[model samples]
Target: MVRWLLVLLMFTGMADAAPPSLYSLLSQGQYQPPMQVMLQLEQNYPGVITQFDIDVQNGELIYEFNMLDPDAKTTVGFAFKASNGSLLEQKVAKLESDDLEELAAVTLMRQKQLKFSQLITLATGELDAYLTEAQLDHDLGISYLELKLLSAAGRHKLAFDIANLRPLPLLKWD
Candidate 1:
């Protein structure tokens, strides 16, 4: 009888461990589709979405997007609640003139060079590394691709220049 009770408890716990369904998440007033949020954002501030993803911040699911302004000179970040599609936060920053110039140059260069996937393959050259983030650094005059790598030693950050596909120095934070 004790063994049967233990088995029953295990099964009951497993039932509670099931992941939340989309309907449930929406009903709870906590999550919403990122695209829906983006549509609303565009209506207010027109821009092109450069990045979009769902992430958990502060124990709540949030839809995040990086938008390139219609003027093609500034980038903006927007975060919305996943459950109700409500605006959570927005960040906008102006790009430096020099950075803008560099960005234009890089854009032209990328058109004639290898794509991101090809560059990653070339950079890795047979290693357990995955691309984490890719961003254009106008200040540095280069596009940076961040890689998460696992080796005999441990996990490490590997940065590479997207323009020339050359490895860049990685900064470590303690």
Candidate 2:
């Protein structure tokens, strides 16, 4: 019984410790705001930001953005230094018809009253999950929030509708 009690205490302590928020990280000078990086990219190629996520690549934090250029009908991917927002990599790809369809859907969904921070809080509370990565994407005329979570079960991915915050099942593994 004593051993079980100790184990429970340890688990409880772990559960009480939530991961730091993105804003806090920014305040600490760890990573630049993804929106800021996206805006810098837009100066050269005006487009709609379809995806934004922070990732560790090559042993450093990389802020990545995927933008849909309506005028060119192409998708541009940019990677920047998380700490300073310096451009590190850029790739431009031809957008497919399906991609455009999804973009339209995402644009419409974002017109609603949902905020990104609120969605992040809801996801963390629901799964007892730590946010590892986040992405905004559209599929089949639906805008979705993709979150990579770190939990006791290890890393898992989840999706939710941006407009309604409804959980979505994993359709495919990437």
Which prediction has the highest lDDT against the true structure? 2
Q: Put down candidate 2 lDDT per residue, 74-169, tens digits, no spaces.
A: 888888898888888989999887685546644654466444445656655656544557666676666777777655556678787666667776
Relative to the true structure, candidate 1 reaches a TM of 0.40
Cα-based lDDT for every prediction: 0.56, 0.65
- Window of ten residues with lowest summed lDDT in model 1: 129-138
For candidate 2, the lDDT comes to 0.65
Those runs of model 2 whose alpha carbons end farther than 4 Å from true positions after fitting are: 1-29, 33-45, 113-130, 137-141, 151-153, 166-174
Q: Pick by TM-score: which candidate is best?
A: 2
Clash counts for all predictions? 5, 0
Q: What tens-digit string does per-residue lDDT give for candidate 1 at 1-174?
A: 988987997988953565653333434554454445656775677544444555655456777766565355787788787768888798987755544543553464356454334444566677643222333343355555454543434456666666666777653211
Query: How well does candidate 2 match the true structure in TM-score terms?
Result: 0.54
